[model samples]
Target: MDVRTAQKLVMENKHAKGFNVTDVPLEVCLLQGEIAEFFTAWRTSEGDAAEELADVALYVLGLAGILNIDLAEQMEQKISKNAARVYERGANGVMYKTTPEQTSAEH
Candidate 1:
């Protein structure tokens, strides 16, 4: 379904398993670990990579749920904002999103 539903399920599972419900720091670390696991699985084998990726998404949704963030809404707004944005390579060789004021100043 949607991200909010998935988030609710993730938190429910975590609660059932007696995980750290309010520990944002620990959850952030665990989310990072899941990302590492997914990267390793992706590099080594494609079959297990999907499972690891699911773990990563699960942790992400769980964290969103814990923080009471409207991830789906935020993602939609961010995508819309990004769509109307301009990007340019900076001196550091990294693409940076320039604000409207910057775009005007550069003109």
Candidate 2:
């Protein structure tokens, strides 16, 4: 039900099939940084934004290839994690809050 349980299940399932590319957060964050850098360059335009974006996108794609993760799926997960609060139950949902790391682990 929780993130820890979900991660445990993933690890358990992976035990039987011979898992690969275990760096989930690292790979995801690396791509995210690249994405940020790309947008930053695009905004500044003091450098080659197009080339920077292309290279970062390609590296991100390569990382995705190694991890066998779909960018769309990952993006959806990221959005979902960021879009709503899991702790909200009553009418006072706005009171609930979490950190960036906690949000990241949920995905």
Candidate 3:
């Protein structure tokens, strides 16, 4: 199923369970928890990685649905933007954005 269909299913399940996640901060925390679970599953190589990843996606989609955001469109736009990005690692070991000119000069 598509993302919209999956999102709809998640909404239906949430409604059936009376799970009202109105608090944005709580929702964000839950999403972060799911992300941790996904990484744990990846590191252990024991649990179902696909299920954990799906859980992360569910939380993300649910949050977007609650906010009335077009997640798919946003994802596409972000992908397009990232595709043209040039990044550099700082002394602090964080990746920072670099201009196209800087990227060309590095080559």
Candidate 4:
């Protein structure tokens, strides 16, 4: 019931009232905090971990909506780009840049 209400709110607020790149960094930081809390709960077997994770996912979805990003489509684009790269798969079945330091050097 709570989840359904959240989903309803998400759908209702699908469109953004305005554009703002400044909000992205703040939202990302909050997302990181949510992730940490979620993992902490999960590792300790605190039953609310799943709900925390769901809340974070919903927040990210809202961020994507505000950016007009279409999260699902953008994720597909990411997959396509990743598949074209030559990196080996990690335990998460996704590959990351070889080295964070060297990768940042290139950028």
Q: Model 3, stretches more than 4 Å misplaced?
A: 87-96, 100-107
lDDT of 4 by residue, 36-59 (tens): 989989999976998989968877
Specify the poorest-scoring 10-residue window by lDDT in model 4.
13-22
Candidate 2 segments whose C-alpha is farther than 4 A from its true place: 1-21, 69-107
Top TM-score model: 1
Looking at model 4, residue 91 earns an lDDT score of: 98
Per-residue alpha-carbon lDDT of candidate 2 for residues 1-107, written as tens digits (9 for 90 to 100): 64334444444545566644467677677668877877888898767788878767555554555565666577777898777645544586465554334645664
lDDT value, candidate 2, whole model: 0.62
Best by lDDT: 1
TM values, all candidates: 0.81, 0.39, 0.74, 0.55
Q: Give candidate 3's total backbone clashes.
A: 0
Please list the residue runs of candidate 4 whose C-alpha ends up more than 4 Å from where it truly belongs after superposition: 1-26, 88-107
Q: Cα RMSD for candidate 2?
A: 12.1
Error of 1 at 69 (Å): 1.0
Q: Over the stretch 39-61, how does candidate 1's per-residue lDDT look in tens digits?
A: 98899785599899999999999
Across 1-107, the per-residue lDDT of candidate 3 in tens digits comes to 88778777887887789876577788899999999999999999979889999999999988987887878788887888788888999999999989653355675
